[model samples]
Target: MLVQETLEFDTPGRGSTDITRRVTEVVRAAGMTTGLCNVFLQHTSASLMLCENADPDVRRDLEAFMQRLVPDGDPLFVHTTEGPDDMPAHVRSILTGNSLNVPISDGRLALGTWQGIYLWEHRTSRQARRVTLTIHGE
Candidate 1:
């Protein structure tokens, strides 16, 4: 069986958005007992990940690290039409990636105890984003 849905959410800007519950809801709605749940972001400036959800600091620290690693306003970036954050956003997205695939077991996502789904917005301004999920299995 294959089930799919597009999830849209507003980002506060340059941080991680906890999307575990939403993705889990999608998976549950799919009614797949054992299979793969794939989440694909539809934007180049934002991405996804499975990270530690137990601590807020972990999210902040990771975002800080990404900012330092891919600082904005580089002279070499030709894609300046969207401002300094544009190119850096793409870089951050490249680092973190734009999709995730998780296993489903017993009608639930097989995520670790401390792990959860995160939508990392790399842009410095608030923007809307969408992630499409597709579940395939029995």
Candidate 2:
């Protein structure tokens, strides 16, 4: 069986926002004992990842690094219809990813102790983003 759900989020920059708990909630609600959970961001300027959740600094550092790598404005992009962050956001999402696959066992996500699922928003302002979660298993 496959179960799917959509979630919304607000972000401030091209960075990661932890969504581990929400994913877990969906997994539990799905009542799947064994399967694969696939999470996808339905946008061009956002992505997903599994990263360290134990430390806030980790996320901060990642955000900082991404900001430095992409910055806010660039002279080469032609798709600047959304502002300076428009192209950079897309680039950041491309650099990161758009989806994630995680293991599920005994109706729970098999994540590491310090690991967490994140929604990497690659926009400069707070925007409503949608995340689609799909579970395939018994």
The prediction achieving the highest lDDT against the true structure is 1
Best by TM-score: 1
Residue-level lDDT tens digits of model 2 in 17-123 = 88888889999999999999999999998888899988889988988998889887778788899999999889988998999999999899999999999988878
lDDT per residue for candidate 1 within 26-130, as digits (tens), equals 899888899999999999999998999899999999987887888899887899889999999998898889999999999999999999999999999999999
- Kindly report which residue stretches of model 1 are placed more than 4 angstroms away from their true locations once superposed: none
Record all residue pairs in model 1 with backbone atoms less than 3 Å apart, i.e. clashing.
none
Residue 4 accuracy (lDDT) in model 1: 89
Score each candidate by Cα lDDT: 0.93, 0.89
lDDT of model 1 at position 40: 97
Candidate 2: misplaced stretches above 4 Å?
A: 12-14
